[model samples]
Target: MPFNWNWAFTWEILPKLLHAALNTLLAAGLGYAIAVVLGLILALAQRTPSRAVTFVIREFVEFIRSTPLILQIFFVYYVGPQFGLRLGPWTAGMIAIGLHYSAYLSEVYRGGLQAVPKGQWEACTALNLSPAKTYWRIIIPQAIPSALAGMGNYLVGIFKDTPMLSVIGVAELMHTANAIGSSSYRYLEPYTLVGIIFLAISLPTAALIRIFEGYVRRKLGLK
Candidate 1:
């Protein structure tokens, strides 16, 4: 039989899908927030004086980045309980996603931080600015313009990857789409809507990221 579109079914399931999409957004937003902070910390840790600390953090980031996100999610959600580290599915999923992406984001941050000129550090030293002040006042402001575009790309990436959270039953968009498809025995409408919803969100987000990047560059007088 030839396939056909089902507008009525699409409309009926959309409210449910939209509700699930909220969970997706929450997971992505929270996860990205954790990633941004943790990634910065990881990047900074590598710059510290202690070689041991830098080595350990570098290895940890490498390990996280090298592994599959699904494995990490399953490990956190399932294997964690074996080690008496039990957490709810949502919590586990968020932590896994955050840790997984932080590894990548840290590299983006490292590149940004490195792109700041050596002369800026020399000038800060000449002015007797403390390390903290040097970073906050001079170095970070410069690094941010270089970092904004990469950071924004990861924000969208984390949103798309929220589907991986469904493996642990987090009930985000993909999980909900699967549920709808299973019940109705019709995969086409629900899955197609999922694609449309993702496209709708990702495209605008990328565009806004570009706008925000340009604004930051202008504000910082980098342009």
Candidate 2:
């Protein structure tokens, strides 16, 4: 068969993809925000002086990190209702993505924390800085650059993984593409467009993260 392009069909599906893309972006954004904050908390918990606290935190992080995200999504979605908790598709997807990525981000944060020099901690102690002040005022500033690249990578990673949410009925790009394909029996255009849309958004964002990471490392004099 000769090559054929259906411009009108492509145009007709564009708005659906755009709407789904917005939902995808929103899920990624909110999920990433939760990951960032909760990862910091997990990082801090690991660093707490109490060995019991550290052990518990490590176990929790490892458990979450080791499990597959799809299973986690299924468990949260299907099992939650049994416990008197109900979640919409979007809400469950966001929570699963957030919690799963938080485990990964926590390690990124922990690595950043470990990268800070012993002298820095000693200096803070010698200065009689409270633990909170030590972390917030001194250690974190230095650790942040180390964490920034990893955190940025995860942000892009989560964005790319938004398609996984579609399996759980969250109406993201992949779901939208599936809908279009099912309705029109035209998978080629819709699926291809989804990939192109993802690349158009993600590739630029990844490049920008690299540029910003370089600038940050140079500014911080990080080796």
Candidate 3:
């Protein structure tokens, strides 16, 4: 009942929490990968020549961005079944996380893509190069350097947001911590450890992201 810390209970629960942390990492990794790919597609979709397509997609992106992640997760997990998408919790959670972050990441990608000079586009057109070749070869390479910082931020952001996955029954760190606290009737240690664990991972991950951004800049000769 007091403000006492129990090392013994902490040690006992550490392994379970650590194991669940792996699930957290997996969810973040897979969700970010999905966001990276889908976000690019969404970004490119908005740049299309068709006003109808661009307007629709722009509004869709805005809708996703404006809504809550929990609502999205609930939609995917609960409402999906009505549309023949009877996915399990992990699948639904990952897809929901992916879609939620993709909206934000698409904006990041669009900023990076737009940073490419107009002359680069003119150069590609001047050479009579196809759009795919132009983008794959020249445009994307230049965009990467600008995008790395933003992408890195989302990578860490996705990691921190993994706790939301637990609402869908994904056994990630926060869910595991909750389970431990509920079972033992001890909230202090479990919650404290959760904060410590998140801090440990987030700080190092942010530092590594900065280092990676620097490495990318040097590699791309931007620095």
Per-residue CA lDDT of candidate 3, range 85-197, in tens? 79999999999999988999999989999999999999999999999999889998898889888899999999999999888899999999999888888999888888899
Local distance difference test, per candidate? Answer: 0.94, 0.91, 0.92
Error of 1 at 13 (Å): 0.3
TM-score, one value per model? 0.96, 0.95, 0.97
lDDT of 2 by residue, 45-67 (tens): 99878999999999999999898
Lowest lDDT block of 10, candidate 3: 1-10
- Which candidate tops lDDT? 1
Model 2 segments more than 4 A misplaced: 1-4
In terms of lDDT, model 1 sits at 0.94
Clashes of each: 0, 0, 0
Off by over 4 Å in 3: none
- Name the runs in model 1 displaced over 4 angstroms: none
Kindly state the number of residue pairs that clash in model 2.
0
Q: RMSD for all candidates, in order, please.
A: 1.3, 1.8, 1.1
Task: Let me know the TM-score candidate 2 reaches against the reference structure.
Answer: 0.95
